[model samples]
Target: MTTSSSSSATHGRSPAGLDVSASFATTLHTPEHIRIAEELGFKRAWLYDTPQQSPDVWMTLALAAERTHRIGLGPGVLVPALRHPMVNASGAAALERLAPGRVAVAFGTGYTGRRAMGQQPVSWAYMTRYVTAFRALLRGETVEWEGSPMRMLHTPEYPRGAPDTIPVYIAAIGPKGTAIAESLGDGVFIMGIDGVSEEVTKKFESVVYGTAGSVLGDGEDLGSERLRTAAGPALAQLFHISYELGGEEAVKALPGGLEWLAVVQETPEAERHLAVHHGHLLRLNDADTAAWNAGGNTLVGHTLTGTAGDVLARVKDLAAQGVTEITYQPAGDIRRELEAFADAVGLRR
Candidate 1:
């Protein structure tokens, strides 16, 4: 059963899920990756939606839909500012036509997408309105947008009609966003296990924990090249977000954070935003490599990396804490990481 529907009586453990970066390198192969996940018993495949850093989310999901039969497909957390509500509704509808009940869309306030463009996240109020409008449009209802009423106008021939129901999820990290999710969303997506609170576990039916790292093999050290290649992108992301949210002072507080900040600051101010997220979730860039060399290993404990048994223990702990699903984003060798994690979680096709 999918994690969303899994319960203690029905399953022994929480379901494992996969999240992929919709980068140019992975977009074409994502369909194959999702197919593998389906074969390995992964319940869902969430694609990243950062236009500046990767290809179109919907287009990539559509491709995945055509390739896989059972795995759920959707944007992990689509940024509301990137597209209008009508546009998002249409994309979700198109995917619904292809995947039917397998589609679920999650909306976020544009943390990475907006920040990469030298902007701040959208307010919670705007996100709520956008989600409300998108849902109404999917239900064949007219909603006022920018002082005018608009609705989905698709017929049976063109893009076809939207599915009767599409599950909505909200990506939340704090109380304000959690409140919005509790009010409107069918589930909640969080960055780590700590984000899944007692109130959230009770309020939301599905609490998906998103994380990135490798399942370390026997005798593998965090400082090894393989481990760095597999986990460095995610580690570097923390620095990127720190710099974006708190600027130089905040980033410098991290391990190797000072040197990382220095390298990032070397970029011209006008293009610094672009530099910060150059590789994003796909791989590490030059600045990231420098940070890793300086002292990034000190922050290894913060990631999901561990031996197979250790990782499994972590997953069980999260499940016990009411995290219904764990979506792991694998860097470097995607297939190897997926297989290792699936095995560690005892998933079967």
Candidate 2:
């Protein structure tokens, strides 16, 4: 089993990373986007894994792998509930073949991927078993799954044989998940700066903080059309997560949460799951738009959005707190967001 150790005190500033939602539009253009990010000195390209909302995560990562030479590539958080452990192991092996040491995989409890399908996140125990089995398969060891022995059957000549190593990161927001991450994951992936606690920074060698929103331009404010367009999709995602985790009462706690709940409530309870996440991280659907028009602007402060300098200051603070990496998910003009953020953070090799 994986266990955490005290990270080296000499760890430097957090490097910048790009997070792509893997929607059709984003997927089609990810190669170019990642190339631009690479040229701009990004450290990694993490594709979201939402089968209901986008193409296959592994396929997208494979495409990205073939296009980029250096930038690290992998899913931001693979939902184990969506695939057997063997399938995930194979997918990681394929990417390792393409990118060699450039592959890194992060596993999560299926927040959007499972919730959108009207299900709860998988238990941490299940995640532990799946990740253990996955690592064993990649190591060319036979592992039992559902009472059957399974292992990679690739010949040495095949490109699918496991590479030297693939670092595993677990996405966690709470203590239970974080504890599991420390015990089982090589690193931990989390959302928001608030997720970067002292215990996490000290426990894990790599703490990847994922955020969405844009690096604001010179004259832009929260109400600026460009800011709205760039930040709306991700801003709305907060409401989706809240509603799913806490239901109507929980959503009512956000800025304009009551109004947002009303719009979501308009859909029948039986099929509300479909209605709540219509656009997801791609665009703001009707309910999300309603939330934005009402008081979503007020929530911008809670996101990664800010003038370039302001965002950079935040990044520096996180680095001081021991965050190893920060992955920014852009909502609009993907290339523009990537370039702007890279420049803002002074990303370089």
Q: Among these predicted structures, which one has the highest TM-score?
A: 1
Give the per-residue lDDT digits (tens) of candidate 1, residues 145-208: 9999887888657653555578888998689999999888989988752355777776777887
Pairs with backbone N, CA or C atoms under 3 Å apart (clashes), candidate 1:
none
Per-candidate TM-score against the hidden true structure: 0.91, 0.90
lDDT of each: 0.78, 0.77
Candidate 2: clashing pairs of residues: none
Best by lDDT: 1
Provide the lDDT at 27 for model 2: 61
Model 2: per-residue Cα lDDT at residue 180: 89
Question: How many clashing residue pairs, candidate 1?
Answer: 0
